[model samples]
Target: MAVYTHLGSERLAELIASYDVGELVSAKGIAEGISNSNWLIETTGRDGTGARYVLTMYERRIDVTDLPFFLGLLDHLAAEGCAVPATIHDRDGAACREVEGKAVALIEFLPGVSPSEPSPAQAHSAGRALARVHLAGTRYPHTRQNPLTAENSAGILARFSESRLAGIDPDLPATAARASDIARQMLGGLPESIIHSDLFPDNVLMLGDEVSGLIDFYFAANGAMAYDLAVTHAAWAFDPRGETIDAAVGRALVAGYESVRPLSAEERAALPLLAQAGCLRFVASRTEDWFDTPGDALVRRKDPMEFARRLEFYRDAGQGAFA
Candidate 1:
């Protein structure tokens, strides 16, 4: 979702030629996300008709060995009729190809824009789609652990000096400590499934108020399904700075999700703490990216304080936030 690595027009054309997707007509670098280098690629099409696709070059935060799980998940979801983009296999039937030392893959481009400010109806549809994804992913045999957890994130937070954390926000250091403690106390024994742990607003594609596609499964893993719901709830129910909660949006999202697959009592009771974990996970990672991502990197460095604010809200609101 970012252009950390630059591949010029000629080099891009060479890469596209390896696939049966047709000669590359044009390639434009996408600069929204931070993990991988992405391009919106257009081609003459395998049958002479034109087509568009997303080309992602694995940069960091992803293990090359885990490529099969990520790419295969897309194919599985697509075949199951979930609105997920399928991976474009190469002429050799390979899911991805290596360029130099980096791995790259072409994804079927799904139409629809990412909503900056989603409405209740949109949130409802997105929630339904997410539930469908969780249900469909049950048959996907591969399992990958959720790498971004409270305990693991505590290690990342430990790397920052007091001054560095204070520079971001005076409250950040305390927020990190509180997040770790809350996550540790709120143990999990709830329903488990393959969850899209990072279903941010940007990761969902919508046409009007209906969700057309759910993108960005890079963070998908085998985890508590309620934790996934909590992640989505935390992501959609707040303002940009996590300062205000959209009450109607929150209610609609849970309602929509329950319409497909109702939450168990344990999942309902555990939601607030799970939401806190979601917020803290972002806070720790964003704090790291704030200090580490290159100045000229073709991606926007998100403010860690946004999620820090959210962590505080979850702490204060308890189950009332979701209610």
Candidate 2:
């Protein structure tokens, strides 16, 4: 449903022809993403060879300057044997092309369905993949700086629309401030690396019980490795009301991650605050989007209060929250 700028058929065909992958047979708009305009493109080779690929037209809110780092990380991770979608270079040996003044690229179509209701095993695999990605990302040359640090969050919240938060809960802003304080003190002390900062469930493609690939690297950046894990724990383990995180699934995630790269004592001790930081981040961003995004934009705004409830849960449970 994120098809903001629609293209004519003639234009689409011309763009596909720019690539050596094949001739364009059919193209369908993929409606699941919120960041960019994506199309599932089908092509055929000169010898009647058919192939599937995804064409992404980068939209606003995504920096054109950061495209190299994002796409380059995909190439790097694939080289490292990670389960990642590969980018297909065009005929002129270019990974990206300008179409209608927008940056566009063709990516190999990874086949699998993202689980609607993930099992414990699936959670474990996701964690395992994240850890492996962190390990591999160490060798990546380019770095994307994380702008969503605790200090920035505090500054954003200072000018935040307090009344909007009161709609979620009168005390939600206070809760966020406390969590931000905790995060500021601890998040900076953990191990840092370039991480897939947006590893939500929808980004994880599963082929049965195993992880097939992870999509969406636009949010990838250098950050605390534990904060990245905490982000996943918030995403994969929480229920709709955010009343509780699934104990078994959360344990599985941490366990699976530990199996790949062991967590330092600092990282482990910072888990609770880090979890709060994760929720605080989503709440802040979602709140901004909930109000700032134009009403006519072809995007869905998630409820910010869901993370508010999560922040409250972590605060109430304290150290044993994720345990």
Q: Which stretches of candidate 2 lie over 4 Å from their true place?
A: 293-300
Which pairs of residues collide in candidate 2?
1-31
Per-residue CA lDDT of model 2 for 1-323, tens digit only, reads 56878888889999988888778899999885666899999989546679999899998789999999999989899989999988988889888899989999899889888887788899999999999999999899888889887666666666666676676568766765674476556645578888887788899999997899999988899888898998898888888667767888888888899999999988988887888778878877877777787757766568777887887777688767767
As for model 1, its CA RMSD to the true structure in angstroms is 2.3
Candidate 1 matches the true fold with a TM-score of 0.91
lDDT of 1 by residue, 203-252 (tens): 99999999999998889999998889998988999999889999789888
List of clashing residue pairs for candidate 1: none
Candidate with the greatest lDDT versus the true structure = 1
